[model samples]
Target: MDRSSGGRDRILRPVIRQFDLKDLPAIVEIDREVGGGYSPELFMTFHEYHPQTMLVAEAAGGVVGIVIGFKHTPLEGRIFWLAVKPAHQGRGIGRSLLSAILRIFSRLGAVSATLEVRIGNRRAQSLYASMGFVVDNVIPSYYSDGEAALIMRKIL
Candidate 1:
């Protein structure tokens, strides 16, 4: 899908691509801006071990969103993190990043995908549901601040 917006005279479209080491700084900044709290080392680890599933959304020549996922088993893919720059939210960037990763997972032979979303994040839950994910379980105190998490799953 064409993930673009703005007036016709000045169209802005986000290009989804595989993550690179050079994108670390921008992605870290985005994670911070969105209060994702993930360490840079974690991003590097994902890039090192699962480059195909680690992707970034670039628009206006800068990274604006990121999705980190990996195949947990031959049949299962796990989405570890997803964050979009606050300034770029609601522009279809997050959805693009997610769809890209899920496609990668399926191509890698995964039969199902799963992710954990903070129970209070209704916006994310809504997006996941729209993409065919259903709540499969819930874990109490899943976050560092004591928030619970809903484990959502979707069949590939």
Candidate 2:
């Protein structure tokens, strides 16, 4: 959480900032880079339609990751997108992003945090599981590429 570092960048402050509509283009591209292939229209629509629940992560330079979710119901939150630049992966950026978003959800009185991950995305699955999310269901061919999605949930 050390945002002001002028040294080796060994200590990341792990910023959790509110995602702006302006960031959608980059986010959509990040999706594609991360193998999530989100359409531009869908990205714009989702962010514009749900600004209250979007979050982005940045470092000393600029935004390198994003995590989007929405209130599924008054008591539940659904994470739609989470992508970190490949160069930044395995550096705790994604985890900090999730932690930040989950805190916001908890403040909104959300009782659970849920998301669907493409079945083959073992890295993401492990991340979610580490965050206390458990697989509760599966939807066949849920992804555009026909990848099955595991519906995971964390009871907050």
Candidate 3:
């Protein structure tokens, strides 16, 4: 897939795998770059609670994408966070992460999956919509910056 690490020219392919402690820093960095700004504690909590559900995409021996999700019940799941390195965006990393998480939810017998995206993030909203996630509700002031969020859900 032409994944190059540190300017080296080599054919690289990333595998979607479970998150590891070493991937934490990369996850935080990607979140900041994407303006997610979620606290480290939250990420740690997600990892500690459902380590298997958290996934990362590694190519050229570096973490480039991540998905943090939690299974709320046998029938419900929530995608808490997803981010891909800015340089890796538009390369299907985000889609891959989402698909991986959804696959896990299905295997775990989750009937539905839910998430919230900023109201103005048309790109993300479009991606979610394309994945069959319909807007289920609106959350006023859902973000710390007072940006409303659109709650989207997909029946898995």
Candidate 4:
């Protein structure tokens, strides 16, 4: 599969939009599918904290991807989470979601953005790198399972 396009077999282009309360379940499902341990409350709290930066990618009437980000300073932002349904992975949904969120961050006066990715998640690392994010440092045991995290940053 060409991870960038939907492929000939799939025809729907995911529409990126603000996250809605109704889309919480789909977001949670995607999180779980991607090995995240976040609870529904965590996601809800993120949405409540910054609903404008919380985004979802909808395709064929269903949420296929989600991203949660927030401004940390006047010129700095962080992307807390970004995931796409397993079946929808490599179909440009994650890319679209990231692009949309970056746009939102840029408009909010973000001069740079940061995110932490699991050291083992090479696919996501590739995506982030392609977006101009570079590994800044390594955080030891950043996850509950004792996995280290790679801190990535991109100057806009």
Q: What clash count goes with each model?
A: 0, 1, 0, 0
How does each model score on TM-score?
0.91, 0.85, 0.87, 0.91
Question: What are the per-residue Cα lDDT tens digits for candidate 2 across 1-156?
Answer: 342544555436668788787777767767777877778787667678776667777775777798888888999989988888776777778898898888888888899999998899899999999999999999999877798999999999
User: All candidates: CA RMSD in angstroms?
Assistant: 3.7, 4.8, 4.7, 2.3
Minimum summed lDDT over a 10-residue window in model 2 is located at 1-10
lDDT of each residue in 51-141, candidate 3, tens digit only: 8789999875689888989888879889988887877665666788898999999999899999989999988887799899999999999
Supply the TM-score for candidate 4: 0.91
Candidate 3 lDDT: 0.85
Residue runs of model 2 more than 4 Å from their true location after superposition:
1-11
| Local distance difference test, candidate 1 | 0.89
Cα misplacement distance, residue 155 of candidate 1 (Å): 0.7
lDDT of each: 0.89, 0.82, 0.85, 0.90
lDDT, residue 26, model 3: 88
**Clashing residue pairs in candidate 2 (N, C-alpha, C atoms within 3 angstroms):** 2-13
Task: Indicate the worst ten consecutive residues by lDDT in candidate 4.
Answer: 3-12
Q: Which stretches of candidate 1 lie over 4 Å from their true place?
A: 1-12
